[model samples]
Target chain A: MKEYTMVVLVKQVPDTQNLTGEAMKEDGTVNRSALPAIFNPEDLNALEMALQVREEYGGTVHVITMGPPSAVEVLKEAMYRGADRVYLLSDRKFAGSDTLATSFALKQAIQTKIPDFDIVFCGRQAIDGDTAQVGPQTAEKLDVPQLTYVESIQELGEKKIKVRKLIDNGTEIVETALPVLLTVTDTANEPRPFIAKKLLKYRKAACEFDLPKILPRYPQFKTKEELKNFLKKKGLFIEMWGLEDIKANKDDVGFAGSPTMVKKIESITLTGKGFKKIEPTDEGIAHFVAELIEDHTW
Target chain B: MASNGEVWVYAEHDWNKLQDIGIELLSKGRELADELGVKLASVIIGDKVTRHATILFEHGADKVYACEGSKLDNYDTAKYAKVLTDLTGQYKPQVVLFGASARGRDLAPRVASKLRVGLTADCTDLQIGDFKAPDGTEYKKILYQIRPAFGGNIIATIVNPNTRPQMATVREGVMPPPPSKKGKKGEIVKAIIKMQNLPNLTSILHREKTEKKVNLKASRIIVSGGYGVGSKENFAIIRNLASVLGAEVGASRAAVDAGFIEKDHQVGQTGTTVRPALYIACGISGSVQHRAGMDQSAKIVAINNDPEAPIFSIAHYGIIGDLNEVIPMLIEDIKKRRVE
Candidate 1:
């Protein structure tokens, strides 16, 4: 098998299950701190496909994420799930990025940090942004082919890969040239759980923000640089890059670069005229259908 | 007249027949164009699909740009994007709209990126408006792309003021189909696209319909269940209700994720968007994700034990009781009504 390099773009999103009324702030922005964050669900599916590719064909799986310092949580989680190397694209300037700016920053990171890649994987969309544009936009930025709503990999070849994509009512099998970007849907594959040994090894993995708090426990490593060197020697240093590290143009990143602006956010309330509640009895059931038929509901 | 400053809608077709969403978009484009003081045009691309341009006129398009070639039969993202991007550069439309179908979703972003413009996906609503950005800069004649986000708990109105030809993909079946004006005629401009210059990066190998066939998008009535349906076997009540009502069966993402039903039967943000004449929900809590798919239905009927379930909020008729009891009673009553 030919060795290939795969990069999976992941996002850490607020857990939708833990949503509360306080999830939205006064400014209509999501209150990220209120909700416990977890790895975006479909992104894990993308990660699994990348890992599967590595397992079938000899290669390395690297995970990349662009978010706040807390996003290292997904990077470490990626390491625990069999990624060989993880890079964190974190910078204060990269905040409030819409999908366009987010994709630009991610494309720069891929070009500068991991220049060569056989395949790029992304979840269909992030639960927070809910925009499935990043993967295709990145593919467009790199001038590569993109396969969205990918279901399964049919055949992997030296120059091309045949895969299945979901359409409106059917699935189409397509063969695309190498160096393609694929946005995997939830049906792509069931993400594998963290390996026990890998979990034990990567559980202690910490980025720069996490180092100071954890360094005090390891007295043997006196300085932050000493602890960093020790972690780097053990192949556990999480590669952290900022906007400057990736050579991203400042005007083209973060709030300044995003073209779409949120004019307003209104909480959804289903204000259908008050419904008529019916008793679960034979007479009531008959009246309900009669009302529906009279009202042209059917 | 040229397509410049015109409101353009990409009319997606599959070789022979035009997609329904294309007509729906033309209906919407007519309004948007009228409001923006621009002509409404439709761009039709496919192998031998120029014949369908007449339909565009009936749907309110003032002009139709038709491109035909064997290479345009099957959708190859890059090739389609290149031709569309070239047209966008030349025509310089103020706004571009597409159906939020699979093909549109794939093609819109690619074109948007190639043209370095903003494209909003799966917008539930589109309107012309003046918008003030967070930086306090005001923009005029912006396309307000409204969509449900964050599990559909809230609606976000997005605007792309900086990019020319502000683009958006609206969901199918949400908008009403236009009333066909049989005598309406439009000018047809044949676009000469060079197929040789396009890159063939991807080729379609095979196309197969999934064994589980459910056309929720076209269904007039839908019966959906959620996690409250309990077990995979317990979903029979839902199926039984659907059969009685002659409606399609639908499932909430929770039920689909729980293995109670196939993904094809799922209806939500990640699944299929549906607009039926009547939607009957049994034991569903109606998360915004599920509601996003079915809220456009003309009427909704919710049956669940929990009165506080969000499903009741939108339901035209609500029944607070066990679905096991309610479904059977409803089915029996419907059977009696047939005889009566």
Candidate 2:
């Protein structure tokens, strides 16, 4: 079997489903701190697809994410689920990035860190933005073919890969050459649960910022560098990279590189007045039906 | 880079018939162009789609760029993106619009990335407006791409101040198609497609266009259920009401996510937008995202046990009761009234 090298992109998004009034600031910006961050739902599907591919073809699944330093939590979660390696791309310069600028940064990171990737998997869209643009845009930036809304991998040969993708009112099976990008959908597969053994082993994984809290607990490690070396020896270090690590242009990595800007944001509020109340009795129902008929609403 | 002061819409089609979203965009494109004092153009790519240009003109396009070839009959992302990008480079239109359908979502991002311009997805509204940046820079007469974000909790107006040919994709049924004129005149330009060296990367082995199982867009009345509908078994009551009233069934995102109904029946920001004659929301709390889809209906009725449910705010008739009891009575009454 040909051992393939795969990369899966993931994100930690605010749980929008369980949002409260405090989820939005008075200025119409999202109060991300008020909401709990979880691994993006569909990204788990992408991770599962990559793990399945690795299981069948004897390969390694590398997971990567771009966000704040706290995003390393998702990297650790990926390891618990079966990822072989994890990397975090974080920097203050990479803030306020739209999908286009975000794709450029991810493409640069991929080129710098994992240039020999055979397949790159991404979720169809994240719940936060729901744009579904970054995967295809990154494929365009990387100058590779893309397959979006992939439901399954029909066949995988040495150089060609066949995939079934969902479309409007139908589905299509397409064949593309190697090094193609795929955006997996929720319908693709059920994500596997965390392995207890892997959970116990990878729970100690720590990134650069996590060392401040983690190192103090262990007096044997005198310095952060020594702690990092020890974690690296134990395969428990989560790699962290910034804009410089990926050789990204300052003008192309964040707000300055984004072409679109938010002009205004209005919080939605429902306003209802002067509605006719109806009783839920038999007579009341009959009267309402008769009125509906009179108004031709039926 | 300066634009050519024209608004362009990508005219998607099935065979020779223009898709609904394409026509809807032309209607919007015409309004935007008239506001800016410019011409409205449309780009149609398919084999022998020149006749469709007349329909585009009737709808609202003042100019149609027809790229005709046998190989272009079926949609190939690479080929279509190349044609649109090349035309954009040549003409430099001030604004471009695409339908946020499957193909549009797949192709728009590629073109936007290739041009390094901004592209907003699933915009609910677009207008010509002015924008002032945070650094005191100002832009006038740019496209204000308005869309709901954060699960429709807030509406954001986005502007591409520094990028030319501001691009955005609007979902179907969000914008209404303009009335067709008996005879409308427009210039038809034949675009020369150069596909010699482009890599033939993807090959479609098979395609199955299933008959659309549900089309809430065309329904005159909709009976929608929400998470409060309880469970999959209780959804039968909703179906009974819809069948009695001769209405199509719809569901909110909550109901769909709870496995109470199929996603096709979802009427919300993430599913389908519908403007029906009558919309009866059953046991639905009416989140902002759900209201964004069906709020345009002519009349709305809400039935929920909780009086504070947001659905009652927009509803013309508010019934505060259990849907299980109210729906059965309503169904029986309607059935008896029809015979009488």
Q: Which lDDT tens digits does candidate 1 get at residues A188-292?
A: 998998999999998888787778898997899889999998988887889889989999998888988787777888777644457888988888888888888
Q: Candidate 2's residue-wise lDDT over B1-340, tens digit each?
A: 3345799999987635678888889888989999888999999999999989888999989999999898887787788889999999998898999998988999999999999999999898999887778999877788999988877777889999998779998878877779899688899999997988786368889998888788899899999999999999999999999888778999999999999999999998878999898999998998877988888888899999999888888899989999999999998888786788
- The predictions' CA RMSDs to the true structure, in order, are 2.7, 2.0
DockQ of each: 0.63, 0.71
Residues B110-218 of candidate 1 have per-residue lDDT tens digits of 8887877778888989998888766677777678999887777679898888878899999887788889999889999888777675553699988876554788987
lDDT of 2: 0.89
Error of 2 at B324 (Å): 2.0
- Misplaced by over 4 Å in model 1 are A17-33, A270-273, B1-4, B195-200
User: Which residue pairs show backbone clashes in model 2?
Assistant: none
